[model samples]
Target: MTVINVNESNFKQQVLDADVPVLVDFWAEWCGPCRAMAPVLEDYANDHAGKVVIAKLNVDENPNLAGQYRITSIPALKLFSKGEVAAEVIGARPKAQLEKDLAGHVA
Candidate 1:
């Protein structure tokens, strides 16, 4: 599946109201790491398809949502389950490591 582009308007429905867990990548176009993680996120979204929802929220475009989540950095990854944040990963990392870090939440 393709990664969803999340914004303030659809944030609630796409992530909060999702039946399955949601992995949200808080990113910005200007961030190098955020750009680097784009393909990784795409691959992960495809692999996890129905199991989890992968989304991208551009911080530059949605500062309110980013501030609400207390995102202090770009490429911040948050795993949300049951409408709440289950885990968070700051900065970019390898897919294996990212999966390992979110193993419990996704499983």
Candidate 2:
């Protein structure tokens, strides 16, 4: 499945209200690290479809979300479970590490 574009408008239903856990990628268009991790996120989304909700929040377009989560850096990966943040990773990392970081939630 393609990644969900989570904004203030549908953030609730897409993330908070979902039955499955959510992987929210907080990124902006100009961030190098964020761009680098895009494909890795997509592959994970495809691999984990139906089991988890993969969402992307553009920090440039949705500053409120970034600020609300206190996302001080680009490429902030946050995992949401049952309406609250379950885990997180900052900066770009290998797919194995990303999966390992979220093993409890996704595996």
Candidate 3:
């Protein structure tokens, strides 16, 4: 699977209503770390495939979601399960570390 781009319009159906856990990466184009985390998320999306859904929501473009989720920084990763946020990672980190952080919810 590939990393999907989510926005205010599709966030409900894609992340909130997903049968599997969804990891939504809140990022912005001006953020260097966000840029660096892109490929890592893509790899994760491919590796996890059906186990989880990886999605990206641009903070710049979707300010409402950023505010709703309280995203104060770039590269904020939130794992959603059953329509609510289950876990969160606040920085750009390695895939192993990220997976470990969200291990409980991912599995």
Task: At residue 58, give the lDDT of candidate 2.
Answer: 96
- Model 2: per-residue Cα lDDT over 5-77, one tens digit each: 8998999899989899999999998899999999999888888888887899999898888899999988999
Clashing pairs in 2: none
Summing lDDT over every window of 10 consecutive residues in candidate 2, give the lowest-scoring window: 98-107
**lDDT (Cα, 0-100) at 35 in candidate 1:** 92
Lowest summed lDDT across 10 adjacent residues in model 3 is found at 98-107
Alpha-carbon error at 95 in model 1, in Å?
Answer: 0.6
Error of 2 at 99 (Å): 1.0
lDDT of each: 0.90, 0.90, 0.90
lDDT of 1 at 12: 96
Give one digit per residue, the lDDT tens place, for model 1 in 15-41.
999999999999998899999998888
RMSD of 3: 0.9
TM-score of each: 0.95, 0.95, 0.95
